[model samples]
Target: MKKILVVDDEFDLLTTWRLVLQLEGYTVVTAANGVQALSLARADPPDLIVTDWMMPKMDGVALCRALAADDRLMRIPVVLSSAAERTPPIEHPLVEFHRKPLSIDSFVEIVARLIGPA
Candidate 1:
């Protein structure tokens, strides 16, 4: 099974995402912020990461940069989501950005496209 790491500061949304991804057949792990997510990734890297743009103790962009700096984590696909006015541009091939208020089907499709079926 593919492993996915989902990072979000909001507890409710995090839980909902975890459940939905798990239901889709992926082994899911979660982190409250980029710091936790980074540690989790270092210890046991996930095949894919889904992160919120605005988070405490390190944002999604910072996390992506950190991951890019590390060869082990750089290959992992990342999906960045934000509700802000504009999404930041990422040059990495494995990184994708999407706006917030995503429908489950759309989100799942992106995930599947990135790392194959959950």
Candidate 2:
């Protein structure tokens, strides 16, 4: 099973994503902030990461940068979501951005595309 690390500040969204992804047959792990996600990744890297842009500690961009800096975790694909209308200015090769008001169908498609159907 493909493992996905999901990071979000909001408890409801975090639980929603985790449950949704798990039901889709992906092994989903969650973190409330980027710092926790980064630490978890270092200990046990996941196939992909779904993260919210505006987190309390170490935002998504910082998490991406930290991942980029680390050889072991740098190759993991990242799907970054934000409430901002425009895409953020992140240029990492393994990173992609998604605007908020994201639909479940689109979100599933994105994940499947990145790491294949679970």
Candidate 3:
């Protein structure tokens, strides 16, 4: 099973994502903020990451940049989720962007594409 790390500050969204991804047969891990996300990633890196843009203690852009900078974690694909009009500069080769209020179909498609069928 593919492992996925979901980082979002909103508790509801975090639970929703965890349930959705679990139902999709993915091994889902969640973090309520970027700091926790980074720590989790360092301890046990996932195959893919799905994160919200505006988070406390370390926004998604910073988290993405940090992950991208680290050679050990740079290869993990990232899907940045944001509701802002202006997207953050997470222009790493392995990162992709997803606008907020994402439909289930689109979300599933992107996740599948990134993690390869789960």
Candidate 4:
């Protein structure tokens, strides 16, 4: 099964995403903030990452940079989401930006494009 790390501070969205992705046959892992996500990724990297840009501890942009600096994690594609204006662009080649309120089907499609089906 493909592993996915979803990082967001909102608890409800986190739970909903986990259930939906799991149903789609992907092994979903979650983090409340980028700090937690970074630690988790270092310990066990995911096939892809879906992160909210305005997280509390560490934001998605920081996570993307940290990942890019790590040779092992740099190539992982990141889907960065935001409800407000788009954040500053990340320099990493694999980063993609998307506006928030993503429909489940759209979200799944985005994931599949990056890492294929679970």
Each candidate structure's TM-score, on Cα atoms with residue i matched to residue i, is: 0.95, 0.95, 0.95, 0.97
Runs in model 2 with CA error above 4 Å? none
Name model 3 segments beyond 4 Å from true: none
Residue-level lDDT of model 3, residues 29-66, one tens digit each, is 99988899989999999999999999999999999888
For candidate 4, the 10 contiguous residues with the lowest summed lDDT are 84-93
Specify the highest-TM-score model's number. 4
| Full-model lDDT, candidate 2 | 0.92
The TM-score obtained by model 2 is 0.95
Q: Please identify model 1 stretches exceeding 4 Å from their true place.
A: none
lDDT of 3: 0.90
Query: What C-alpha lDDT do the candidate models reach, one value each?
Result: 0.92, 0.92, 0.90, 0.93
By lDDT, the best candidate is 4
Candidate 4 lDDT, 1-118, residue by residue in tens: 8999999999999999899999999999999999999999999999999999988989999999999999999999999999977578686789999898999999999999999999
Better of 2 and 4 by lDDT: 4
Query: Where does candidate 4 stray beyond 4 Å?
Result: none
**Steric clash pairs (candidate 3):** none
Local distance difference test, candidate 4: 0.93
- Across residues 1-118, which tens digit of lDDT does each residue of candidate 2 receive? 9999999999998998898899899999999999999999999999999999999979998999889889999899999999987665675679999998688889899999999989
